[model samples]
Target: MPGIRKSLLQLVFSGTSMRRWNDKMRPMELMEVDKQAHKMIMAWMLYMLNGSDLDRKDFIDLGDKIVLGGMYDYLYRLVITDIKPPVFYQIKANPAHYQQLTQWVLEQLKPRLQSLGDPFWKGMREYYADGASRDDLASRILDAAHLLASQWEFHLIKDLNPKDEEMDEIEANFIQGIEGFQDLIGVRELMQGNKASLGRFAQLCGQLRFQQRWSQTPRIPETAVLGHMFIVACYGYFFTLMVGGCKARRVNNFFAGLFHDVPELLTRDIISPVKSSVKRIGDLIKEYEFKELDSKIFRTLEQGGYFELSRRLKYFLGVDVGSEFASTICLEGDTREVEWDQLQTIYNNDDCDPKDGFMLKICDDLAAFIEAYTATRNGITNDQLQQALWKIRKKYQQVSLTETMHIGGLLADFD
Candidate 1:
């Protein structure tokens, strides 16, 4: 069985420091992690758009591919560390040099990644060892999402740095690369000329990058809601794997983690104290979130004939289930709440479409704890940050998410 380790979790968080577009002037520093968050979210949208053409088995395979591809790309970026795109592609143009560099990257990753078990390590090694290419539909979707996300970042600084000579070439490359994936579902709609409703939804989701978490607190390398969502999703996926979750459970948990905070994009990040300060303030917030979600997001998608997307988003948000943290399973065309034990023993299979909501909540809390811990470690010793670190550690000190994964011991590593 797989087990979560400090090295694995720390490896995922390391992307927080890997800056992007560092060669250009910009409004704000764009990090590699944020771009990854945007890319995966867009990839999920593309995956859903193409669902009609895929079967259940295909769904499982494609979802795993998108996530693994994202992880591999992140690791590669960490190894390359801000190499200019042109120069990097030139390295790729030389097959021998590229293979040599890939070997080095694999060597760098093995110590940090091998703990996840042989299956994951073998798959990752074979992917690069065999030459990573965009041959499948999932690869096309992920590559298109990556291009579109990078283009979105470029648009942020385009007007400010108008005199940069390479800007036009960069923009043209983005267009050309994205165009190559237009044959895939959802790619054409996101292109420059299209006015798809899904495009608008993507833009709305992208705006979360500007909404910083812990909005009032000062911290080194502040994180945004967008990147935080992605981190939690990653934790959820890994934890599911560790706990022996089925394919559908793994995918559902990942996506549920990814969209858990979608309503925050509309309502903005409300700290827990404010939400619970008044008796029914939390309830009122939920009511408002649903209303805004229906009006601004769901209605538009449904009107545009993307009913399935809207339905899935609603399911992810736990609209009918009352809370996103409630464990759930689909049975006989209806979603029903189930106890975690029942889910593990009975419905832990593809046909049931199980989602480990409680586990997702643990992942969410773990992500938040890590965020606080990282900021504190970076020399930001403010009271808010310190208190956050203390609170989460105290809460999970005796908690264990699985038989082999002890939360208290994991938290102790930061001490």
Candidate 2:
């Protein structure tokens, strides 16, 4: 009986050792697989980051390619190795590989952790989580990752966030305000005309345009137009209060700055030379624009049951009516040729006053020049600054008497 007990104890100890060995070996194998997968995924990410300058047209297809080629391998290796054996065996036995892959990807990406710094590392961790459905996981992961990546490309790469604490705070707060406004009113839905026109007016202040020209110009990134508008609106509100304007006027000034360049949505920034050379071109362009606005674009909105959207835009932007403030805000003709008297008349309009125009103009110029200074700090030439300054100074001459005095004093201080 004693011999039998000793033999049983020895058998149990040997079994435990073998089990530990097998467990350790499995992880070693998994690690090897993961290393290969990691290398492959890293290469793929690098390729995607640099291989193509994808525009709006290429985004979907490129996303598909990344999922199939890179994400699939990384996700599959993780699930097969890291997940509990029972689940892994079940998934491996499933015939629908794509479905399984999708499910696993979703499980990994559901939390959508943003890259506080390294997107690649965060993405890898996301890929390794083995619990969620693939489609949902992949969607969330890609969305968050892409958002951070886009911001990095557009803003950070240009060193827009300067090292200076004050400037960083100013820029950060301004961006936060813009993003907050978007969240407050649901910018995506508004821009698509799924919401009211006033909402769209708000969203318009958030849309970023002219990415290519952004790096070259001394102006704020076209992407930050909405953001800059919000800042201007804030300043306009404060300035109005300082000057003892009515609350209604202050609110109007904010809206004016917010929607000041909505026409650019259609016309883009028609450069000065383009507007100057063609006779009757400005009128023709406006006529074409009015037709387009009334045609497919707005009609599409109406058909889609966004009548409130169209109505609100028409009311706030004064699209159908003659509004001196709106007209002044419009980029109709060559600003180079615009007369001081013409500008004064626009400022003195009944619905909006010169004070609003002056505030808007100052804010606009200040934004432009600050952007120029930022660009110069980022290694852009003084030539770019000079060009921006020249364009701004041209309008300075056309400002109202009050604006002229205020801006003159401001410029003197800067000098």
Candidate 3:
């Protein structure tokens, strides 16, 4: 009964409607509750942003004090219950109720909306009408935050126009490097590749740990996948030091990590749960994905004639871009028809050692888990880390227990 009541409350607040309540409640009470709920949701969102670094227990403590706790439970139920919008729209048929709800939402959001700049306000204004789904909300939020943070980066850049020609050239090379890849990846428009914008992306990537799922730990901030690539590249360098320091191996490791997930540009980050769930439905989805990748994502990159970009990525990683080694390095796991032993024999025959690539995988998982731990510290409960660790441990049994323990300890420290 409590759960049902709570669900009804959430439906009312989330612009959904209940038939029974519409007929029974007084207009004044409905309007008052709706207004309060709107304010409460906004306040909770702000709190989540501000106290994002609080630990799980502390976050729960704060959330309990705020309206977010209720909102969280409510949204979760709505998602699980698979409630239909038509039911809500029926309640919206009540003209007074509809007007009151709209007015309340607008009034509550007004201050925050006005505080944002014109560009941001324009985007927000179009967001609802544009049919922006709930999934796109996170990306849009990150984009908006990046836009806001760019003002500071711009000011910082203005102070750094060096007079030295060589220095200028070096700076130009960095810009060119980023732009070159941007075009190749077809993310040029999305990222803009400007110093301020790149800086914002990097910062947000670190802040949000976008590479990671949500956690009860505090999040780092919103970070672009490009930023994660950079971190992985750096980790690859360190990984080389830990193992025998081979120049070629190090280069390969870095490049592999850099371009490993570039296809995500086309697919967006397909969350693992969704991917695994679709497994039961067989290869239909995979076939569709492959077609989508070839037609939409890969075509865009190919049009940029960025084969050289691919070469550079492979060159730095010391692998043949067209080789099976390259495929394994770029794509996680083998999708081929070969058996495990056969695949191993193929790698052995080709002399394409899996060591460096495997290490890079470890680094990737480490960075991701660390990001999750940080998110959990911030006030998010992210069970994804535990799930991932379990999965990886099972998947990479060949990985030394010592190495696994070391990586696990490193991640656990963040907790």
lDDT of each: 0.84, 0.40, 0.38
Superposition error at 41 for model 3 (Å)? 39
After superposition of all CA atoms, the RMSD between model 1 and the true structure is 1.5
Q: Report per-prediction Cα RMSD to one decimal.
A: 1.5, 24.4, 22.2
| Candidate 1 vs candidate 2, lDDT winner | 1
Query: Model 3: how large is the Cα RMSD against the reference?
Result: 22.2
| Model 1 bad stretches (over 4 Å) | 192-194
Winning candidate number (TM-score): 1
Model 3 TM-score on a 0 to 1 scale: 0.38
TM-score per candidate, chains pooled: 0.96, 0.41, 0.38
Runs in model 3 lying further than 4 Å from the true structure: 1-222, 280-293, 296-305, 311-355, 382-398, 401-415
> Model 1, range 1-415, lDDT digits (tens) per residue?
4578778887787787888888899899788878888898899988888766788789888888888887788778888886788998998878888889899889998887887778878988877875645477777888889999999999999988889999999998988888788887777766542277888888888888888999998877788888888888888888888778888888888888888998997899999889999999999999999999999999978877889889888888888788888898887768888988877879999899898788888888888888888888888888888888888888888887667888888888887
Off by over 4 Å in 2: 1-223, 300-309, 321-359, 382-384, 397-405
Worst 10 residues of 1 by lDDT: 186-195
Please provide, for model 3 over 113-218, each residue's C-alpha lDDT reduced to its tens digit, 9 standing for 90 to 100: 3432343334344433322232332332322332323322333333344443444443454455344333122234324423333232223222321343232323
Q: For every model in order, what is the number of clashing pairs?
A: 0, 9, 29
Model 2 C-alpha RMSD to native: 24.4
